[model samples]
Target: MSELTTLARPYAVAVYKRAKETGTADKWSDALAFVTLLMQDEQLAKAAANPKANREQFSEAFLGLCKDHLDTEAQNFVRLLIRNRRLDLVKYIAELFNQYKAEDEGYIEVDVSTAFPLKDAEQARLSSVLERVLEKKARLRVDVDPTLIGGVYIKAGDRVIDASIRGQVERLAKRLWT
Candidate 1:
């Protein structure tokens, strides 16, 4: 994991820098996201990682798949990754690029899990509160997990706020033991 991260960081940085200069971070994000999707496909991933596959042929096929979604610069980026045999790192690059984009845009990526799906009003209220607490705009990825029992669980970077019914019960049980 560390090795992959180390290899991916430089590519992410370069992409982020290019996006910043071109004033096209959103476009770059979309392009990288498309690449990420392709890489996630089992067949395509296998083809990309197959050591016996001809490099030039695969690169052409890959770029062909990306033709509509990627701009010229992004196509070049894909070519560079193919040349470096780092196509497998597309997901990590996209993730790191998003981190860079979010930090620069004064936003925090937050995960909010609830026992039930959040209403639009609830989501707005929660987002507003989190923005205040985190001191950055909150970009929430909300999910519903039945195991949470009730209420919400929020995570941002290393911080976690557990307000779920199961968490409350666990805390209470621990206190009673003490």
Candidate 2:
């Protein structure tokens, strides 16, 4: 994990706890996403990263942009982050928060690296197959990696399935050498 992610984890956990208690995990997820998007603004990002910038001013401007999209709890959450100088970690926090939400909702995020791009039908089939094998609803994020040589490599949480041609060759080479 990145240093920022480690720092953001506690905040994400706090938000997640509130979300669970209020049964509004989805709302919190959306709010975090929206706040993260807003943070991408060039001016806002500069101000957020500037230690000399006025926290009150920055918080008001940030909250103003968020008031329409975020609930009161989310606004308060933003203020707390600003007060603690953690605005820059919003993206990581949002990511971790969403992952927590997905797990709670019985979904597993999967990363599939393949030598070639998959067609819509191919992606659907692969997703279905992964869901069956993993026994959880899979959310696949696909990437084309020519180094894979052929086939696919699947990463879901701590589990890795190396079905790629390059991976097979490396395994065979390792066994032969041993």
Candidate 3:
């Protein structure tokens, strides 16, 4: 795992526990989504990175941007992050939080890359196969990559099964060279 992932795990777990206790998982999900978006904005990210911007300024700007979307609990969470200087972990935190949410909901996040979009039936088949392979229900995100040539690359959590033509060719070339 990356350092960011390591740093993010505890925060994600804490938020998940709070959401579970309060029966507000969806609300926290929305708030975290907003925080993730705010962190992605270039200007806001730069401002957050600026040492001259005090914690109060960062918290105010962040909460201001998210005012309509946030509840008191969410606002306090943002303030806590700012005070702890963990704003840079926002993205990673969201990622980990979503992972926990999915697990709690009995869903696995899968990434699939193929040369073209799969039909509805094809997608269903892929999801079925992945569910069977992973022993969990899957929610897949499909991406079309022409450079893949053919076949699909499936990633479920830390496991990657690359069945793409490019991957196969590269392996073949490596084997031949060796």
Candidate 4:
């Protein structure tokens, strides 16, 4: 995972820069997301890995399938990936590109895990609190983890706020053992 991100970062940065210069960051975001999903398809993965699959044919088929979503610049980007056999990096590239986009837009992506699903009001309240504390808008990726027992665990960038029941119990146990 780290290797892929390291390898894909330069390309992702290049794409993001181009999109920013062309004033098409949002469009490129959509195109990259579509391409990433297309590349993840089982059949496409098999074809991409097959030594016998004609590279030209595979490239044409992929472009044709995504014709509606891609513009000229996006088509060229896809071609570059295909030519370099870097299609596998599409997912990482999209992720990195999204990170760049979020930073440019002055927001941070956060992952929140809870024992139960949060209500809309609960989510909004949490978002408001996080934004106030973090001093940036928060884009949350929420998940339910029954093993958490109760409360919430939030991860934003390099910071973690673990208020889960399991986390509290672990801390108390560690202190007692020490």
lDDT (Cα, tens digit) per residue for candidate 3, span 16-44 = 99999999999898889888988888998
RMSD of each: 2.7, 3.6, 1.6, 2.6
* lDDT tens digits, residue span 49-160, model 1: 8988888999999999989999999999998998888999999899899999999999989999999999999999999999999999999999999998999999986699
| Top TM-score prediction, candidate number | 3
State in Å the error of residue 66, model 2: 1.2
**Comparison by TM-score, 1 against 3, better one:** 3
lDDT of 3 at 120: 96
Candidates in order have lDDT scores of 0.94, 0.92, 0.90, 0.93
| Deviation in Å, model 4, residue 77 alpha carbon | 0.8
**Model 3: lDDT of residue 137:** 95
> Each model's TM-score?
0.87, 0.77, 0.91, 0.84
| Cα shift from native, residue 78, model 3 (Å) | 1.2
- Candidate 2 achieves a global lDDT of 0.92
Please give the lDDT score for candidate 1.
Answer: 0.94
Question: Residue by residue across 92-170, what tens digits does model 4's lDDT show?
Answer: 9998998899899999999999999999999999999999999999999999999999999999877899999999999
* Pairs that collide, model 1: none
Please give the distance, in angstroms, between residue 29's alpha carbon in candidate 3 and its true position after superposition.
Answer: 1.7
